[model samples]
Target: MEGKEQNRQEGIPLQFCKNKTKRRDKSFNVYIKTFGCQMNKYDSEILEGLLKTRGFTLTPHIEYADIALFNTCSVREHAERRVYGQVNMLSPQICSLGKSKRGDNYPNKRIIGVIGCMAQAHKEKIFDRLPQVDLVCGPQNLYNIPDYLEDIAKNNKRILAVDRRERPVDRENFSFRNKRRYLTAYVTIMEGCNNFCSYCIVPFVRGREVSRPPSLIIKEIEVLIKKGAKEVTLLGQNVNSYGRDFNNGYNFIQLLKDIDKMHELRRLRFITSHPKDASDEMFIAMSKLPTVCESLHLPIQSGSDKILKSMNRKYTREDYLRKVDILRKLIPEVSLTTDIIVGFPNETDEDFAETIDIMKRVQFDTAYIFKYSPRPYTQAARLEDNVPKKVKEERHQELLRLQKNITLSNNKKLINRKVGVLVESADEKGDYLIGRSRTDKVVIFKGPKELIGKIVEVRIIDASLANLKGEWIRL
Candidate 1:
């Protein structure tokens, strides 16, 4: 939208996703089309958090919104395709928004632009397909959002704000409410990855790991809590590798210790840990921190040492096993979760067997198994996409089948245990509510609406592959 329409408007544009009463008619409402991981979700939330300060409200549906943003992910191939599809789906809205105000367009034209990884990878190419896209921003270019929006308001031309390199700071300090209603939130402590794992493009696409100063992260977490956040998961491509980019002594463990001291935080967690950086000190810190959740999402992409080396995962099977042993020994009751990339080029059945072996051995409480999708411009793409599609599917199904058994077995063990559950919302019948334990297991039980915002104890009566049935116990 142009500066003129923005200036002439009596009230903000239409808000499809925002709470109407709180939104000004003169402001714009934005719906984010996020396609990626928890980190992308966090980044989108941060963008909305900033937008809230500028009198913008967030919408849940994109088709009818005043502004549309696509938070893209490039971890796998299909993920990027999905982002493009989202942009195409919104084309009519973009054109209509553009057509309505052509002579004196509000110019926000709903300002459809792509951001995050896809924007980081495809950059200007996105515009070639969707020229109506007013601004294209990347994960690291988050701070430039306001400026890009401002530039579009004036010039009415497309602007792209994407950079793979880490830019130290860009948080505009907006409170993200509804994190459980605003419950669990992922807080990005650092941006980008330094590890150029042969199978990954994160390093080239996201640039090197640049840790947000510990103080900046702490301040961000404080704001999230004030807005009613109960839990936070510190985010980075490699969380344990945080602070290595600097000479400062503050590391991931130190950050955890500091955040753990926050009086308002009920639980804390982190993810996408690299086995290479899963340092001893971090494990000790996790065991000691009272508020730290008894769970970790360390991704073991492959279990065969040969595949590990081929993937350039840095750590071998023995190394990863040692780290797992350390975590188990130190945090005895810690619930373990992981990511498994099922098929890589040249993965033999024996290699596949090794991964299955680890699944049985770790008995991971949860596993997100996926067949590998070759992403463009990654080192892995340089190699032949040798794993047959059928084989990849079979490997993926086999892993899931194994994980289902593992999860059910672990959940069965939780039966009869009274655990702390942070009540999220009422069940469909209004007869029950749902929440997660510190271990991040989903638990369901009968409860009053009043229990929605508080953590309560629930006695487990039954279990399932994906969730648990429980009875809320009055404290």
Candidate 2:
């Protein structure tokens, strides 16, 4: 997933069908197995919206599904491998149905497809590997999935829709898809990335940066707010570089200011900001905006200048520190989270020490640490992956151990304090309700079922490296 964002269930309105009188048969079901970032989840929501319009309902059980879609990711080799394994596992069951013959029930024959980054990256090669795949669509072509699925059903042949052109999002089209009455929702303000980080495959698979029109974005948020969304998270590959593609003066900071004017909104958040593009003006806006949450997911891939430069990250260690210092000064109570990659090629013991040093200085509330893995067709792939697997594991464990101590220490201070939490869901065990604080910390507390979609004050009673145990104070 992009920047290690946790996956969550996206809501789809129960009455999304075009005709109010027409009831869905629930015979034909589409099962979407998403394996990527929040953007991919948004894409899956769009897919669900499109399918619901076409009279198909989503099903959790793949065995009973008429169509199974794998929304894939290529950020890491492991993600891709998982997709491959899933496809392979499902191929036999799909193939056993055989071709659609005369007088046969078309609904009985399953259709399997792959969408998103991995589909865009592999294209037809995906067919060569997984011959059972009936459709392969890219992220840009998601809106056209129903049409392609229709064509496949009519002709009984495979199809691919991986257009590279910049596609405009139809916010009005998917307005009814916000089914969740949760206080928080994700609004993708932009798509793709322009920064070609050497080890990253996002730019290649997701294409270049394209910011949605501000008017459309604001309108979408308004629709969401009207439907009971209290917080909106602006998503992008690099949110800080949102308006750079446009000739107009509209930028991310300006967008934030515009959204801040929406008094109905209680909080706003954004993610995956590149350190170099995180301007001081943006931090200032964040500090002043009452709706903007006091949390930032700024990913500093590495702390060693040599490793950063080699990864084409553009910012030096000191430059990132300066930005962090500025942000801390402006928002004293802000919670900082970061993404770190260990054992990059040519990194020495001293370089690893620099990463630990920076972690101590920054004291990030949470850190997502990943071991270096060279991606195909990326600049780093050409270089030798000289770091041994054992060494990488050691470095990863060391960083994780260090970050856990820091996180636990930091969280300990929150005990006996009160914080507002937006209740999202009950834990799997059903013993406690799980939600997030304004600072994005996971808080678990016992509460009524009615509190699932509302924000309430909670008093922290216990703390751990990963989450906080709290007691409900009030709604």
Candidate 3:
């Protein structure tokens, strides 16, 4: 997977189907399973759009589908393990034995594919491990999926397309699949990362930073807004590094200001801001923009300057603290969230203590703590994984317990306060509506189904570590 191969294997050019605008077909169903983060979810939507244009239906059940695609993540060893487990389970059930729904019996099997980051990272290794897979496509080469499927059906041969090319995105049609549209949408403003954090594999799989043209993004958001989408989250690896690839002075702040001017847009959000790129202008835009949500996800992988330096994070503990201060000062009621890695190579007790101390000071509303897993071809992988499993588990539990208390304390402060929530869905019993506040906290309250896509006011009455119970108020 690490070694580069020809852009296409076995003379398969990266291309889309000629008849992409054909009417949708009800027979062929594509069941997709997505793992990892919001970026993968957005990528799945892109796949849905591409398949839909070629007349395939999206199905929730895997039993009835003619094709199955696994959109994978390679961020953590746990994620990779889960994908392998699922694929292994699927091999005996659907590979080589099952017949296609079309009853052609030429191939005599359902088409199985491995796509996204994992496919890009592992390449032909997947074929060696899982012989039942018919197609493998990387994130950048998604547009070639339909054509590859056709070739597999015709030639009965395996196809692998993990070429690192500057592929163009079909923004006009592929922004969000029409069949599975949601009120809250995710639009990618940029792709890939430039920061090669020592412990991360994103740069290897996703390539360098490339910003989508501002006009295309604005156009896509306008379309989503017209389709009754009330909220939009811009997806990226590190959103703070958005426009660095461009020579023009236009950057992330300007992008937000332009998008904020849309009168119909109710709320806007973004994720995974790098601490090194945190800027005063960006915070100011978030503070003043009416449509931008007050929630921010800034990842500070470590608080120990020593560990931080080894991770190639480029920012120190003091630098992170200052950024947090600026954000709090600009948006006093802002909800802060972060990512923390507990076990790194050669982490000492003092390093772990620094992480605990910073968590206490920041009091993040939420934190995603992960036990470090050494990935192949990474700098950290070369170091001795000195921390034992028992110690890592202990540190991980300690962080979780501390964060639980902090989250409960923060939620308690919201009691008796009015917050605006965009109603997203309802519980199975239909007795309660679930939505998120501007601060990105889940708030559930009794409401009519008619209020699903609207932003309504809710007064917090009870608080919990997971969510808040609120009383509905008129918009």
Best by TM-score: 3
lDDT of 2: 0.82
Report the CA-based lDDT of candidate 3 relative to the real structure: 0.84
* Candidate number achieving the greatest lDDT relative to the actual structure: 3
Candidate 3 structure quality by residue, lDDT tens digits, 8-50: 3453332222222223343466789999989888878877888
lDDT of 3 at 457: 95
- Locate the minimum summed-lDDT window of 10 residues in model 1: 1-10
Error of 2 at 251 (Å): 1.0
Positional deviation of residue 192's Cα in model 1 after best superposition, in angstroms: 1.2
Instruction: Provide the clashing-pair count of each candidate structure.
Output: 19, 0, 0
Ranking by lDDT: 3, 2, 1
Per-model TM-score, in order, reads: 0.88, 0.90, 0.92
Say which prediction, candidate 1 or candidate 2, comes out ahead on lDDT: 2
TM-score of 1: 0.88
Cα lDDT tens digits for candidate 1, 1-475: 1111222133223222222232225456677777778888877766776777667667787755667888888888888778777677664333223322233433324667688888878777776777556667877777657666656555455666765444544453544322434676778887778788887878767887778888878887888787788888888889988888778787888889899989899889898788888888888888889898888888888888888888888888888888899999998888988888978888999999999998888889999898887777778888888989999998999888899999999999999999999888887779878899989999989878888878899999999988999998876
Task: List the global CA lDDT of all models.
Answer: 0.77, 0.82, 0.84
For model 2, residues 244-362, the per-residue Cα lDDT tens digits are 88888889999999999999998899987999999999999999999999999999989899999999999999999999999999998899999999988999999999999999999
